[model samples]
Target: MASGADPKFEAELRRGVVQLVALDYLETPRYGYDLVRLLGAAGFPVEEGTLYPILRRFEKQGILSSRWDTEGARPRKYYELSAEGRAQKNAMLGAWAQVRDATDEALKRSMEAGQVGSPDGAEEETTS
Candidate 1:
């Protein structure tokens, strides 16, 4: 009985926040396409539709600061995390750690019972 969806898959509720997440991943300012590819390599796999809007929104919200870089034939907007954004990312990371720990424990128990598909989910490859 195959439904349209894969039972092993799950959607990230963190939808529009990849820009903030990307900021934490970057050591310095990054332009739009660079940020997209970087996150994809890191396994977040952001689409341009999702990332570009978030970048603009974060810039508007003061969590990001941007400047025009004209080194190329055409200019591009480069984004860096503002002081407030860095502080917020730190706080979010702390909360995410707690969630991850709790989820890991639950998955461990479920795996022991053969209850869920992937015991470690996305964390498996990272672990070993």
Candidate 2:
């Protein structure tokens, strides 16, 4: 078994963060492949299956606007953030910061109390 954090938990974490990262990228217009390349280069390798559905959903929700470019050999659809998208992205970023800070504080408290890997870990659970 691989040691360290659970892969499933890590993937769930990544999935939550990807929305913010994708929205940040869409601040400027880009096509699907461009997003894949840029995100991959940035160490966030997103799959087409994952990315396209997000783009389409955002477009459908009016958070993103799309235009077609037929000037090239093949037509491509480009996506950009709409006004509402920018506002939503900002709100999401702020909420993310709060969550990150809270998690950090909780971890710090756990470490200080020497409860990080305690056998009775469930006793530390709290409903917020």
Candidate 3:
């Protein structure tokens, strides 16, 4: 019932994967802006306002650690994954893989049954 640009669907999808992607990038120390650039380059496209809060939450949860870097003209907080963060990332990745496989299987079945879009983008019906 929703269109392609449905805000609710977009929010739900992003919320589900943001943490996993963030953790993946935090494997290396990076500042907030750097994360925005890197993640955007990787097709994530997270805004600074969205990312900083997530970083803070991860830090509070002991999944990330941060240090102040003053080497540049301005100071920045660099974040890296903690030991626990690495373990959590691995677990999340495994769970994501399972979810992806299950969803793909369900979609394939739906398409085969003509309950959804066909390979040519046409709606199909099953005859009894």
What lDDT does each candidate get? Answer: 0.74, 0.87, 0.87
Q: Which stretches of candidate 2 lie over 4 Å from their true place?
A: 1-4, 115-128
Residue pairs in collision within model 2: none
Q: Which stretches of candidate 3 lie over 4 Å from their true place?
A: 1-5, 115-128
Which prediction has more favorable TM-score, 2 or 3?
A: 2
State the local distance difference test value for candidate 3. 0.87
lDDT of 3 by residue, 60-115 (tens): 99999999999999999999999999998999999999999999999888777764
Residue-wise lDDT of candidate 1 within 40-104, one digit each (tens)? 88757778897888778878888789999999988988889889888877887787788789999
Over 1-128, each residue of candidate 2 has an lDDT whose tens digit, in order, gives 23378978866787878888999999999999999999878767779998889889999999999999999998999999999999999999999999999999998887765654454575554557
Query: Which 10 consecutive positions of candidate 1 have the poorest summed lDDT?
Result: 7-16
Model 1 ranges with Cα > 4 A deviation: 1-9, 13-20, 112-128
Among all candidates shown, the one with the greatest TM-score: 2
> Which structure is stronger by lDDT: 1 or 3?
3
lDDT winner, 1 or 2: 2
